[model samples]
Target: MKKLKMWLPFVTLLFMLAGTLTLQAQRKQGVTLEGYVYEMDEDQKFPVPYASVSIASLSIAVTTDENGHYVINNLPARNLQVTARFLGLEEQTQEVDLSKQQVLDFVLLVSNFRLEEIVVTAESNKAGAATASKINKTAMEHMQLTSLADVMSLLPGAATVKSDLTSVTTASIRGGSSLGTAILMDGAPISNNANMQIMSSAIGGSTPSTSGTTPSIGVDLRTITTDNIESIEVIRGVPSVEYGDITAGAIIVNSKTGRQPLTIKFNTNPNLYQGTATHGVNLGKNAGSLNYSGDYSYSVSDPREGYDYYRRVTARIGYSNTIGKWYTNTSVSFLSALDKAEPNPDDEQDVTIKRQNDLGIRANTKGTFTFNRNFFKSLEYNVQFAYTDRDSYFYDEATNATVAYSLSKQDGAVLSSIQGNKIYDVNGNLVTNVPAGEESFIAWTLPSQYQYDYTVDGRELNTFAKVKANFAGDLGATHHRMVIGADFKSDGNVGEGKIFDPLNPPYRSVSYSDATQRERSYKDIPFVNQFGLYAEENFDWEFANRHLQISAGIRYDHVLNFGGGLSPRVNASIDILPEALTLNAAF
Candidate 1:
């Protein structure tokens, strides 16, 4: 009986397989629609390929392809009901009368709730992926109370992280230095000081420091309160045309839209000597959002590191609105910092004492064309502009210019200024080019920079469009799900630089300031740009009953100046026990 038990089950399974195929074959008839199944809505004018589609009462079914189009050459002449499904979207159904040759199409609306599909679980934003690895720095609300530098540390590949008492923090991303990846906030490009990893001032002037001096800090990621954020998406490799330059990958950060009711909050961090308050509210029947926030901190360095000190303040005010098919966002911000550079007694051979202060403002705007329910993914266009003014004066044991536009008694280096005692001789006045002489004394020394030392003022405008996917598909589903998009970025910059002419008063002096004075002028770059196209796919499979997952994707990047190339990514994961104990690997 025991032998018969095992043998019987095996015999039964073979017959079941034979029966299943025979039934499937019988259900298919000549001159019938035998391709994959699909569901579409008015927003999408094509098949929802790779999506599950099957007859509600029968086993007759097939999945769609990369084109969102399906092809089935045979099916019986009978009335049938088919169901279709895609993740994060609603399911759909269609009824067909096979008696008469026919073709049917469907459009599925977004289901109000998606989380309802899975229950009783520890939820994390970083869902397991089959191909390529990803780190979702998707923080919200209280998460913003921290710095961007602090947030990046939570990723698996970025295990090495350090933060001083200040806001600046640094980490390693996928074995690469922190500088390897590009960082952007609300469409604004962020750059860290070449020496430390803290953010530069918002206006390109004296930006505040988050931590102590080292690694020349970049922008402090922690300051952008997650409350005002709408979404944060980062893709590793798998480069897309929509994002170019800075090769590793791209991180897309978008702010919140005021579609909900008013919200207000206050936050304080004693560790960094900071306190902040933020407010957000929607207006009019359209429910546009208006948000504002401010923060200030005073930081004192550890005696062991140095007597360095930092004080900083920053704020943001913005509005968001949607009109018909167009949506727009605008904001203005202020950032300032005062740093103390105690006298360098060690270099006293040329002993130097210095202190610098910087203040500036930045403004930004974005507009987009959107299709709420369209299938080709919503289309978007964006534009932005900014201006910055930051100036500073230096005083050494040598000199200080107390006058406006005067080159006298100043650390020398001026472009447009005058000084006294025009030395003269020769025929009547000095004949040689040296305005000043034992040597015609035309002027002394000018400030090394009239626009304030090391300042950057920028103005830029950019526009681009991209396609997005609204759903996720299974790995072994024998279907092609992808992201297809393209975009372009156009930007330019202009600012002032200091020049010295010893023959002219201001700059002639070895003195630091305009003992006399010289010349200064503004400079600008006409434009810089990026453009390209991208697409990717995830493969599905079933191996040894262990939910196998795999994904492979590639993209083509095209730069006008350097041309184009392709990048590929492969990833896989195995289930030790269904959903738990997952062993994932990627390259």
Candidate 2:
């Protein structure tokens, strides 16, 4: 019995050791902790490529790949503390309970400045990108930019000028016209591509010529106001093939989004006043979250104490959310403006220019999907629609009433030799003219003879859509990213004008009505369609702990109307003294 008792104790210990060993072996059966690292970008989130994720307890750390994905194998199933960090971003720490193979995602926020011993994200500080600039909310607030035009003027080789106090503002880059520069709001174009000018002449006379001057010429920067804006990105030099119909450059604007503290803002100057409200909150995991922003602004060119001559009102609202792997955003905006024609002192004035009304509306929607696939990392799509309407009226003061002037010979043929206010006598033959009645016709004056009342109306519709895919992989010793996209656009314009000239004295009569005296109108609608396909490849080689980097990229764009354009870019950077000095070159 004593021997059995001793044997029992030894047998119990052997059994216990065997059980512990078996349990550990089962737990270590190739378990792994894997997930992706992302950064919160206003309304949506994007992967932070090359982020650092570590576990101090296990003395193990790994850097994310191009798609922000990482995996740690053979980790024991238990609670652990994990930390993720990136340069110019706040660090994040989470308690992850690794039971079996677990998936956990980290969302980090952007920091105000770069941190020491931090790894930089691929898209944020592309070491070899030569012509990319970022303007954060802090910089925008410091500059107090009122419009996108103001933002572009601060860039290299870009300029925006206002000719007069009431004149509209225009933008240009590197001596390129505004038409060549693509202005983008949420990755879609917002430029006007139709005529909005109105011109008319007497019932039968030639149309009045204003020397080709038109209202709302080019992309009117004055119509764009900065409200609830988060950041702006300017691409000046060679850009990716994903962008089309752009020869000069591109400006991309991003708005505030996601859950945030509710706040109200108000600002004003001598001629401008603005107010805004913003809010953000979480709404569970399945239902996603919401972020919203709304703002109103009023501006004037002539705010003479208590009186205002020209004024404009603008309002906008934006919303964003994320559900599962899909993220969506939407926005709506409105604009209204009024202008009074400047009076001429030399011309005898009885009637004055009436108030003109210009109104516009715009809406946009965008969505993105993140997936783990063999060929693509993510898919993105965007759609936009916009409309504009305008109206104006012009009349003569001297006639005291709208009138139409007409001239005819005794044989009933119309005459066309009237020069200035001087009229010539018409003979029986259409080509025969005499000065016998010149004094009487000249005395009648051109204003009274060719007076008329007219009105002009114009409208436009614009729409755009695009789909793109992003892919990343390794080729040889270099990292590679490929982008492919297709885009389509449509623009249409409609305009109408009506003119009525009434009866005047001996030189002009409406009842007998010569060929030139009558009522007339004009109506027309023009449209344009555009389509494009593009592809680009970006590659980089790193050596010696990132002490030297060489990046090269090439883009191919095929546009329906513009044929094809090829853009090649190369950039190199070398860190000489760690964080102190770096040499960069681009071509």
- Whole-model Cα lDDT of every candidate shown, in order: 0.44, 0.57
Error of 1 at 481 (Å): 3.1
TM-score of each: 0.51, 0.63
For 1-587, candidate 1 gives per-residue lDDT tens digits of 45345445534543454344344444343334544433445555554444445542332334444444444444445556666654323556677876774676556554442232221112111212422232222233324334445545444444433333343454334454556555655754543322212223221123222223323433345434344454455545333333444545445565543323344444444334555556666564455667776666555555333445556677778887656555577887776665554544455543232333435465667665433121121344344443333333222332343323332223332222233333446669642232232231333333444322222222223333334332122212232223444545554333343332333222123322222322333333244555654444443455566765454444456656756665555556668987668776655
Q: Which structure among the candidates has the greatest lDDT?
A: 2
Q: What is the TM-score (0 to 1) of candidate 2?
A: 0.63
Clashes of each: 82, 5
lDDT of 2 by residue, 364-424 (tens): 8897775523334567899999887766655543432233333432333333435434234
Each model's RMSD to truth, in Å? 15.6, 17.2
User: Among all windows of ten consecutive residues in candidate 2, which has the lowest summed lDDT?
Assistant: 118-127
